[model samples]
Target chain A: MIRLHRCCIALLMASAPVAASAASPIELTARVLVEQRQAAADGTTRIVLVPPARVTPGDAIVYTLIYRNTGSQPVPDLVVASPVPGNLLYAGPAEKAAVPEVSVDGKAFAPLAQLRVDGRPAIAADVRALRWRIAAPLTGGAAGQVAFRAIVK
Target chain B: MMNRILSPVALLAGTGAGLLIAPQALAQQVRSGTAAGVSISNQATVSYSVGGSSLTTSSNTATFVVDKKINLAVAELGGTPTIVARGATDQVTTFTVTNLTNATQDFRLEADQQDVSIPLLGTDDFNVTSVRVFVDSNGNGTYEAGVDRATFIDELAPDATVTVFIVANIPDVAGITQANVSLNAIAANSGQAGTLGGDVVATPLTTPDSPTTVDIVFADDTGLLDQPRNGQQRAFDAYRLGSAVVTLRKSARVLSDPVNGLASPHAIPGAVVEYCITVNNAGPNVANGITVTDALPANTDYISNSLTVGGIGTGDTCVLNGSIEDDDAVGADESDPYGGSFDGATVRATLPSVTPLVPLNVGFRVTIR
Candidate 1:
């Protein structure tokens, strides 16, 4: 027996489809803690990503860095150099609490001519986003977050 | 192709296709099954004894007397009706009302069941996302008549009410009909004339009705255009005594066909972006051939192949690229003491398209006379 249900209506005009935010465990694997440790320069208050992780194809990882200036004298040309991971997609703009600078490879550098944090966004870059430079000098015992995105490959 | 694709005018100008929609009961009717042996049976009759009224052997009246007898009618037949939820749009919620029992037992979900049927109708039909119902005494799901008599607000008795509030797209839908409307809201037993509660039944004393007026809203961005200047200065900055600009827009209006195909005219509706650049003129002694350049956004395919400046050796300049309909002149009014004065003496070029990360170079060059 077929019951004609007029309940269903409008394709484009039907009730909003509930946004299913339900998450299922598609795949899960835990990594050992020893495999994910980064070493920073001595006396310098910044840590560098020796081997960056690719969270996704086009995702830039924002690492929460904790740095303490061990030295007494205030570091003037205080530059924090974190290279953009070569494997991931390009990073857009970055946010810097202290100062900002940008580099492609490890060597050549460009003074991030324009450093700004929006009343809203942190920075704007050509690439989707990843790394950014804080162009300000670090005084001592100062920490902040730098955000950037990676262009999807 | 107009309707085949979306109607552009309606998309940009007016909201076409009001939130009103027909019941999308479309089906491809795909089915798969093996033949379970088909069985056929004739309709059987149930004969229940009436106990309320006894028929006189020689009754003067021809009317059959009604009885308070249990009508145990167990007429068994085969198949069950399948009601598949038909529409697939993300606009409004819909529900089905099925009279499955032989005597049309008005059934509602536990939530949509009502206490009374006099005022408003019970939510037998699903129209919105969730379902609601009424049961006064035993809210714990005893639906048999007289067992746990459901007390609901009755609209007919002027105490109960039933209303189905279509909570979506209220602004878009205009016409609502009350043909077979079941009430979800009612003010009943105003002065203590009625009991506290009752189970609301979803049955139509009259015709069925649906709500009109649906709401439709769109998402949007909030902020305005803002930029943090990079070292790269525009050419007009060099040409500024007080203020000046490069007339590169002429290149957009009058450039030759490039080796590539001609680009579309730069006159799209929502494709203009405002930009500012600063340039400096380095001098040995009054470098006369100074020129500035500006590049079109990469998204726009160049109509003419390339852009070239006739003479650029006097001063720095700033260039602005935008839609053709815009009448904003680059160097409208200004003076210059740093170098020779030229009103619209900047260069212009159109890039193939915008390449993120990869810099699509768009700058002026000096002849260095």
Candidate 2:
């Protein structure tokens, strides 16, 4: 009797659309930090990033996006998108495993060289959002991070 | 003896008959005069016949004197010069209007900017905001808002004086060294004349001892009728403006890690730079509406939330112990001395008011891209 019930439930799940039955297994988080100069025990100064409690104009800020796969199976063709805050001007993305594409209106995406504004090539200042495409599949319990810099307007 | 007695008796009887029968027939005469001792007297007589004999009697004389007169004078209370600043309100000059008349009278007050030209400096004309005639209710001679009453000198008693305040707003103009304003007081019944009533002819007498008649004839010391006495009582005040000077200085330092720990910092990519801007005002007067702005350096990214302000030492040294104020860390208990904000590339700081000799320091950090 238990085997018959399991078979019947499997048939019902199969009748539904495959895309509708599937669930996203990826988790994402965003964080911001500011750079500061600190002195080491050896009397040498080093640049370090720290969480910011306050910011002023002309201050540089770093935004980081973290991703993790929580499902039993591998997640393929993963893409991440982040919108730049209005009060900050886009600088550039930090070095990462995959190159990132930029958007001026958060609609269309293209490489940094192909992006244009007012029929002219777009500069770093014109970027409004960032998109990253991961080439390698993320296995369950696997994680990765992407970051970019911006200056307060 | 019989004739004499008959004649005396006849006279007495005639007088009695005249008093009783022709009392209305006797004419009583009167003459007009002024309080200046112009003589005025009245007399009356009566006549009648008794038993074919004629006799007459004369009555006693009556006299009266008029005492109607009004006079007033206005003078500056003190010759001291008043000091005023441009763009200042409630600048006041005081004067005393005295009613010298023997009878009570009302005086109208007026203020005007005189045509006194100071060609060397500039035009000294300024309009008065308001003119108030106040009776020193407290006898303090100083005008108090709620204590002093704002009204004309209505029925000012003889030998009574009232203080008049001419309030004016000084305009903001350059090269204005001095200002002259005149105050005048004339009797209310001066018939549109500019002087007190003393100089004008007294109104035609309708009734004896009427105070109104005195106003028509009261004249000022200048013998002018219904005009301001004491020649408008001009008051001169001096105007002085303070010179304001402000100076701003800025400095920046870069900090970066070197291959050798003992080496100094280099301005390489990813290096952090700190900037300090100091503003000083050397002035005799406070500088109002002060603002400081600094554009972010090229090829640099501003460290988000890194803007701060602190009181610095005499030099460019940043005092760590000094109260460090953060633009983003404003809490309910904390207050920012200067309003600060950023517009992508530039940082702005606004100070509502600042006094002279005070130095203001503002600091922020940026990173090289």
Write model 2 residue lDDT over B1-369, tens digit each, in one string: 234213423433444344335534322100111222222222212222223433222222222222334456776666643566657776667778876654455676676565665444344554444434455556688877667665555656656778777666666654344565666665654333333344324544353433112223333455212243332222233233434556788878775544322257677777777777777665536778788789988998877656655454245644432244344434431255556656688876666555666666767778777
lDDT digits (tens) for residues B125-226 of candidate 1? 223233323333333322333433433322222111122111111111112111111222221111233344232222232522211111111111121111
Estimate, for each residue in A30-144, the C-alpha lDDT of model 2 and write its tens digit.
Answer: 5566665689999999867765432333446676666666566666666665655544467888545355687766567788789776667988766666677777777879988
Candidates' TM-scores? 0.16, 0.32
lDDT of each: 0.23, 0.55
Model 2: DockQ vs. true structure: 0.00
Residue B287 miss distance in model 2 (angstroms):
17
DockQ for each model: 0.00, 0.00
Q: Which residue ranges in model 2 land beyond 4 Å of their true spot?
A: A1-153, B1-64, B118-135, B189-215, B223-369
**Number of colliding residue pairs in each model:** 107, 24
